[model samples]
Target: MNLQRTQTAQAPPAPRPGPVLAALAAAQFTVMLATSIVNVAIPQIRAGVGLSEGGTTWVVNAYGLAFGALLLAGGRAGDLLGRRRVLIAGLGLFAAASLGAGLAVSPETLIAARAAQGLGAATIAPAALALTMDLFPSGPRRGRALGVWGAVSAGGGAGGVLLGGALTQAWGWPWIFHSVAFGSVLVLVAVAALVPPSAGRAAGKFDLLGTATVTVALTCLVWGLTTARGTGWTDARVLGALLGAAVLLGAFVVIELRRPNALLPPQLFTTGRVAAGNLLMALLGSVWIGLFFFLPLYQQQVLGMGPLTTGVGQLPLAAANIIGASLAPRVSRRIGATATVSAALLTTAAGLLWLSRISADGSYLGQVLGPTALIGLGLSFAFFQLTALAVDGVPPQDTGLAGGLVNTTRQVGGAIGLAALATLAGSVTAHASTHRTHLEALTAGYRTAFMVCAATMAVAALLAVPLTRRKGRADGSRTPTAADPTTLPRQGRATRRTPAA
Candidate 1:
């Protein structure tokens, strides 16, 4: 008798997306809606909850603090644990937290619940992103999926600006949180029924020390900056917190560099794509945040519209953005990334420049509509491309870190932008000679802020130029074969040099 040997192998089946996508999109929209929806309800919440200035402001800040500070940790958890599992847990927690917040009778309770909601957001966002990548194998399919997803992420502020007013005026402050809570329940139901569980990271340890240090640093820095708004920049408390945060961040950098399993590996910065993407994200985030803060005042206080009307008025911007963000991929494929990104930034700058020309008598159609709509259009262009660039070329092993970095860019950028713009606007208002002059002065301040944003974003567009090649590159632009498991870690390491495509 002769012995026969046979060997057979089959490549794992290709991933297919289930109904989870629709549910995930809903969840993302709700999370983003939290930012804009709450702005219109601030005054009501303040009166109802007995919030002092800082305390009322903290209602918003608490959510941001938790989400921004803990995003890396949450993402790491999703990578190590199953993403579906994390998504479920996050949605459940978010619903509960939102319920608690909606029913809150006190500022303290509201702030606490808001923070919990943010933590939940941190969990859901990364898991959702990871799931999207896992589901789509890239190319045109992923691009379209990403275009829609990017709209949810990037165009959120405009939606918030419009929806917040309507919800707040029609339903009340609690309705904002209540709506999210209810929507979250629906998302959970959809996710549980439709999504398939995927394998988590094979073997990696969460960088607890690195996460802790970074968390403390971000929390401290954001806290100090926010406080510095009312208090002088030189206040002892602000100074101490800022200095402490700096030191902690320094320590964090040192710790991560040495650690075997750093949360955000230092080597990742070697990829130019990552660097450029994050930079642009931060700049655009700042502009987006500042827009919400000032526009309501501009429309309501300056233009003499009711809250509901103001919200309704912003619908044009939101509507335009939705259209623009959805079509961004088509634009990119035809024009190439550099031209698209630069055009967006320049358009945004021009819009702001137009806003600079606003007089006290400026009409919504004549002035506000043009500028805000352009802002919406420009932002969609920048945001979609920047998002594509951020996660581009990232190695599978570093997906968690890369996703976390993108979230971090947006959060930190918004924090910094809001702080800088609000402070400048306040200073300008103080210097105005008359009430009319004050609105004009504030508008003047906004003009300057917009110019700065435009300039910064232009530089950001330049950074993308080197990254944007005629054809998609490995890291900066997602292609069908870009997700090879073996190339993942290298993507992380080279992230800083990759630029964007």
Candidate 2:
């Protein structure tokens, strides 16, 4: 077996990829596009569906709740079944859900349909990432692939804002969903034709108990945080939901400890890089998602910009993000992923600090653009570096799980952090209103939120200190082993190496 494996590794590599990457990137982009595409259209959606403001919030939360909670299960399913199979299934589900959301007549129906879309996203994201990892062997080639993926992933939310505004203004709020639905169908077809079949399934039983517990816990937690923005943290329903989350999460931990085929194996967490990378990703998500959520509101309400103008204003960010992502791979090769991530975090913090000075009468060009560009650049760098580092030492069989875990942190952290920040912003606004005009009060709230974002980024940078150093090969560069099961071989049977960088 050892001799066979050595011979296989020395064999010729797979053919150069062509359309495969484009399809995978499109799949990822569409899933993330749903996250913020509706933000600018919230008012239009509310008016169209006759939704109360609270119901409107659910339109967003329902999707987040489902997406954040089910990511792990979806990832594991891809590993147990087949990555390609899961990706196709997920895309199909998303397309159908988007159709329902686009056509729904009532808020409840739309929210449910949005939840279905989230479920589809949950399934698609992990599988798509795992497939990308599978297709691209780590080295300069994988780095380039990840650079593209990272740029697309980071830019997707900003792109969504742009696309959502245009679609909503030109057509209607429903077109936002319709557009994604149509795109999903195209990408699904492309994926079916371009992506090769999965090598085989992993040997394992689905950890049903573990899956249920973690999913329920995350759902409860995200739902509670989202609900608290409207209902207040002290509200009984919010409190109960949070309590239920704690209980469920506790149960999940116990289940994982005992289960043989756990959804989130405990050993993964014991690794310093995995643990640190995930925690940092969560912090970054908090700030990133918070910025995406609030910046548009600040621009529109405070700066008196229209939806189209607001979307247009964000174009610099999208452009800057792509530039930064494109550069991160090469930068990491020089400075190491850890240092690159840490510097990017600090850069983001600096940018947030600068932006925190936002006033009631701030100029978009003067105050907003500079910091927005800086943060965008920093985010792209941090996002790609963190993603690579997070899965650095994991075995091929567990690659899907690693992808799911990191993505889960991103989604869940954004949900929880946004809630906490929103609460803080609300309190600040209310207090400032006693002494200032409404606009001034609102500016104070936004500024305070930005300061908190800066603080969170600073903290993440501090945590990254230990991660800056890693043990690599004798040349001080990490190389991918041929036994990596994530890689698709053009010649021989799939086999896996023991986990290493």
Candidate 3:
């Protein structure tokens, strides 16, 4: 009886999917929230810190640049070192960076802090996602979990504007950073308690050369795109940065192909629709990121709304996003993943076309809310479907790599799209300003951007028809592989141990 009691007591408890999902979703939410929260607060931050226009731009760009550049390295580290350990370390660093940003009184300090926060975010995002994959085997359960993840992520992007406006109106801009800091701490504690430790999958030398070349290349690309929004694309510095990025990327590709232990294995792309999925993800992100940027500007600048009102105006979009994400798995099951994604993209394109009809004297209800709601719904559906496709059939050891690759594609695509769209809008506004009123000209520019975005989405929808059509369940379901927790050796326990660092 004593032996029986001891055996039962030593057995591990069954995993609780709810808390794990909540914690991971919360971490992603905080990362995306930080990306946009600062946008509404930019004017306030500038006034408080005596920032120049250029400095203010950096304050926004710094986080994205660092986050986009180091994602691959961070994801690889999580796979080789340990996902749980990397997550905790990332949360700690993110908390500290947020606190520093909150306390910063100088432009330099704030920018630096923001960059550090990006680094922490880079570490946290892939590790959190990889852990989610570990917890849920690929099937209906994983699909549902990813649906929640998609909902919170899209919500976070829109919610940041609302939360930032409310916080800035009530207390100040500093509280935005403080709120992130507090949230990170809470997530850190929850993850530490709820998540089981897993060992590193590989025991090999780190891919230092590939890491360096790719990181610098990504940094240059992001920097160039960001600069193109302020200084024209023809500027010398922008051209130089673009050239440098191109050269470095070639070197990185060569290194990856030759190295036995590549940071990004070439075979990963050959695995079940990964390449096509990432390509579609890039297209989706291009419009999704730029839509958020121009929509807020149209509300505040042309419609003459206050920060808080503009933020509140986004409620319809957020609601639609949640609803769409909730329905994505079911929709995919019913209609099929490829069909769902293609239809969603077409839906988004139609909404953008409607938005292109916005007038100088447009009302929020007619010109903004309806179209934005449609966009929110469609984009969420596409995002959820594409994310699942991107990671499908990935190997057990490379789960982190798959997660990182998908995210990197999205961010890079967003950066490029935002820069191009912003430039096109600015030029249109400038040209129209010569022949029209300021408000009319601004509206015209915004309208032009919407038209372009719609065209892009339409093209993406067409591309999706051919790209992801393969023999599988119409729902895109697959047999569980070694990547699934149930199929993993030692029941998903790590093969080797190492410090997170």
- Candidate 1 vs. true structure, TM-score: 0.87
lDDT tens readout by residue for model 3, 363-389 = 998789889899889888887878788
Candidate no. 3 TM-score:
0.91
Local distance difference test scores for all models: 0.74, 0.84, 0.83
Model 3's alpha-carbon lDDT is 0.83
lDDT, model 1: 0.74
lDDT for each residue of candidate 2 in 1-501, tens digit (9 for 90 to 100): 999999999986663475889899999999878988888887788899999855765776677768878888888889999999999999999999999999999988999999999899988988888888888876667777777877888899899889988888788899999999999999999999888888777789888888788878887887787678777889999999999999999998998998888888999975536787788888998888788878888988899887788889889999998899889878876666668888999999999999998999888998899999999898988888788777776777877788888888888788778778877888899899999999999999999999999999999998888754554658764443321212223112322343332
Off by over 4 Å in 3: 1-5, 471-501
Question: How far off is model 3, as Cα RMSD?
Answer: 6.2
Clashes per candidate, residues 3 or more apart or on different chains: 19, 0, 1
By TM-score rank, best first, the candidates go: 3, 2, 1
Report the lDDT of model 3 for residue 9: 100
Candidate 2 local accuracy as lDDT?
0.84
Report the lDDT tens digits of candidate 1 across residue range 1-501.
Answer: 123222223434443364567777777777777767777666677888899865755776788778878888887888888788988999999999999999999878999999999999888887788777777654656666677777787567767767677877887878888988988899899888777776557368988889889888988888887788788688999999999999999999899889988888777766546676777778777777667766776777677776688888877778777888777878876665667777887777777667666666677778788888887788777777776667776766566567767777787778767776666666566566365576677666655666666666667666656754334456656432221222333455566676672
Question: Between which residue pairs do clashes occur in model 2?
Answer: none
What C-alpha lDDT, on a 0 to 100 scale, does residue 108 get in candidate 3? 91
